[model samples]
Target: MDHIVIGTAGHVDHGKTTLIKVMTGIETDTTVEEKTRGLSINLGFAYMDLPSGKRAGIVDVPGHEKFIKNMMAGLSGIHLILLVIDAGEGVMPQTKEHIDILQMLGIKKYIIVLTKVNTVDEELVELVVEDIQEQLEGTLLEEAPIYKVDSLSGTGINELISKIDEESQKIERSNSLVSPRMHIDRVFSVKGFGTIVTGTLIEGTLHVNDELIIFPKELRTKIRNIQVHEKNVNEASAGMRVALNLANVHVNDLSRGDTLASSGSVQKTWMIDVKAALLPHAENPINLWDRLRLYIGTREVLCRAVPIGVERLEPGEEAFLQLRLEEEIAAKKGDKYILRSYSPMHVIGGGVILDTLPTKHRRFNEHTIETLKTREKGSTSELIADFMNRKEDLLTSMEETASYLGMPQTEVIEYMGEMVKKNQLIKVHQLYMSSLKYEKLKKDITAILDRYHKSFRLRTGITKEELRSRVASNVKSKDFDKLLQLLADEKVIKNHETISLSEFTVTYNKYQLKDKEDIEQKLKKAGFTPPSELELIGDNKERKELIDSLTGKTIVRLDSETVMFKDYYEEAVQKVINFIKQNGKMTLAEFRDMTGSSRKYSMIILECLDKNKITKRVENFRLLY
Candidate 1:
């Protein structure tokens, strides 16, 4: 069953409160001031069982002009609107303003309820209905079903309730796959319960004992209890009006507009990029640096609107804007917001947020404008690609990217997997890069290797550190290791202790080859006690380079003073293993006698065996490693 929150909107004293009472049999105006003044001052909530057995939450908003902000606060989670118009007064000023707000905030459905039909004659009632129908032209409510009822007499009330039930089924259920987030509109402390917050569960599910973070302040807390329509439940689903009992928190620490969400999901921002437009009858154009009142998700903030790609946004003109906020807010992409004049708060315009986390963009930046347009209109996959392409060479992680896109990490990974197959994205180990960036990086690596090979023909490869510093220094160590190994697997590069192009090899002139062969023969002839490196180098620098290149491949450099040919080194390793296997251990004297070498040579060779893990030294002997 779809959990729906329906909100009441219209002029003051339009019978909104009494209508809710007639529908739900519950008095919504519970505050003493409201009872005394006979007007709603803040939000009032009630629920009723519809014919379909779906419990529809009813939010009663203050219709007075002074409390319009309070009205906006409760309407954030509403799926439908009860646009109340007085039968005697027809369409009032606040009714018009409320309709504008509803349209701007993206309320998809509304049922026009004309109250106090008993007080008006049949002709007057028909005239009022016709006037409202004419007034609703060019709006989402133009074709809305209008019902005339008298709350005091309970006339036509059942028909309105049935219509509401029918419309409630039309509401698109909130997605439970997204991370849960709720903007706290009320926070108070009960005597036994620590901190209790009331709001609509906007998306996902909140379970008892689930860890939560309040954004904009980021106060950490846990859910101790969950309630929907005042009944405790193990979990609350999206679109339900929720009252959360929060543990380890205080009423003073939280306030209205603080978002309760899973940690690292919803972001806090002091700036946002949006596609803003003005109401058709707006009084003034939006000028640059115009301080405006921004109402988003129950939070009212002071912000400066810097128009993009235009100097001033006239009435009914659409433009991109970067709203520089005075206070931080927890917002996500596609959240609709209302804009009001800074001093006297009246709805001037509103638009949907395009980017919650955006840099301060200068006016008239074509690229920035293009990006905003795409983000506002593009599909989800396009949005991901656009965001990734903007990152240049940086490898994006799933958590951060999902947070920015306002999606679950698992869901983003699914989209990313498809993109990878389409060659639109590249998965480099655990990180993500745009295919454009990946191709550039691949080309850069190949060019660097080409230059290195040409610059130093005798060198086999470049150190891994040098390659990383040139390719992308910010790449994590483990990611870089995986990247190099991947390149080697693709046959684009060869990775060992160092990295090189797959086709790269050390080359030597005929004279240098003679010196390399001469060094190899000397080491082979001096098998038991190979000549030292310096002895082999003698006076030739090129001989030293050739000998150094042969170290780990054809020669095992035992120490600075001792070296051995690869074959002799293998023979000595086998001898130590054979002796240890038969005699259990071998001493330096035994090896010296066995090989007919001196004590110095024997000690060096034994120590070399220990270094190579061919043998382990006991007290005066060696054992097989």
Candidate 2:
């Protein structure tokens, strides 16, 4: 865990800023516009040393309705919040709106403060406190302890600070294990420094000199320096307010919505899949293709909500949605977001991101909805299993799985070890094929071999490359090889130079047996020079197929224009061996005279011998291999 951040939220004139000024002695509202209006216009930052000896960072957000956008940005990474309310007026409109935003953002820890108690009598203060407590019911702050205070006199401020310190000590965040990411809420240039950006370190740790990239722009940069609470630091972790001096970028090129993260950690995308819910108090239901403004991690983009498995979403109902955006934003799975009406610009609903990148989904698709539901609520194991099962035909790599599931590669790898143990996944080298897919592939192999054998009974088997192209083309070559070996070991299939069913064998049918004898007799009669396959079969397609099946098995096709019976081919081989041994070598002309054949036939036989390595050709003569 790193530093704990605290934020202020309430309506205007709630004394939220004054309470902070009394505690930290640093006025957050420094701008002339803010001073002149007597209201915080932009986000302000201050830090205070807690009684527990830790410096807690504070964000003072503008309470005015017009600055709700800034308020939402300030609230983005804080672990706890101080929901201040004046004792004079309790539970105002903006107060309720802030509470709604806080709840929608899924913040859990809150400390309700009832400020300016001196302006009213004790009875009225008690009445306001009761009203505030009643409004807090069924909200996140229901159990939160409220403190009565007067920021002007500094009364009851010490107790509030002590409570904040107590709560901050209980915070536990994963700052060390994950990659660092920060959304830039402020971008400016100092006198000597280059572009500097400030935001809360949402996760992981950032170090000086660490190379990073600004997302949506994809401009690479290095961290020149790091600062926390006006003090230079070598490193900063999650939950702390951080300012980074970046190299190789200009202030004008940066903006408030840009994200700074470890390079390759995030990809900019317009479409995102999420489990979204419309607020119960929303003015109207959200229909498909209704353009809405999306806010996540201080970045806002316009998008259209295409509800999955439904045409429109009623208030308070949760469903899977594919948001099609007008522009791109970089986000990760599980990040919370808020959606505002395009024209009115009020918070209508919010959700947690399920997939940073996803293809456009069809409306009312059961498979899409089911898969998204698993992503929304399934465990790590369930998520992994569901993903592999859904993409059963693909060879999913660990890196690809981790990116889609929004998990660390090491974490996904660890879970994969367990998945293989449980027999849920079939791991082949660096890839994973689902156990279900393996079974289906095994079945397909047997079925394909069966069909091939029934169609051509006198052939050996299908080639390995042909089988793989039909069954596992998307699988890696090495992975498919290993799968063949596994299938062979399991007795599901036979793996050789060519793959086949374990029980498949070449056998001739009755008609093919008759054709085989007839063909052999004809070849024997022809002796040294047999008719070509085309001449023998003529137009008999079945006989032609039978002869083709006998190739490399029973009868040998000497050339495109010739064929030889197995015995005659062997007799020719012996004749070559004897002739070569007797005469050391024999020219094609001499072999023609010995076989009593023409030059063309003699050349074909000698060429076949040369190909079979029974004889080697030297110029125009043949010699024993």
- Top of the candidates by lDDT: 1
Q: For model 1, where is the 10-residue window of minimal lDDT?
A: 385-394
Model 2 lowest lDDT segment of ten: 170-179
Candidate RMSDs in Å, in order, are 4.7, 7.7
lDDT of 1 at 386: 78
Q: What digit string (tens of lDDT, one per residue) describes model 2 on residues 1-625? A: 3477899999998998889999999999998988898999999999999987888889999999899899999987888999999999988989988998898899999999999999899999999989998988988899999999999988899999999999988887744446788999999999988788999988778999999889988999999999999999998987889999999999999999889988656768888898888888889888988999898888778998888988788998987889998988988778899988888777888889887658888787788787788888889988877767666356777766775565667898999899999988888988887788778888898999999878877667787888889998877677789999999999877787567789887787788789888887898888888888877787777787677666666588887767887787887778778888998999988888877877888888988888878889888778788
Q: How many backbone clashes does candidate 2 have?
A: 0
- lDDT per model vs. reference: 0.87, 0.85
What is the C-alpha RMSD, rounded to one decimal, of candidate 1?
4.7
lDDT of 2 at 140: 85
Backbone atom clashes (below 3 Å) for every candidate: 0, 0
Clash count, predicted structure 1: 0
**Model 2: lDDT of residue 65:** 89
Model 1: lDDT equals 0.87
lDDT of 1 by residue, 393-446 (tens): 468877667766767678889999999899888787778888777767778999
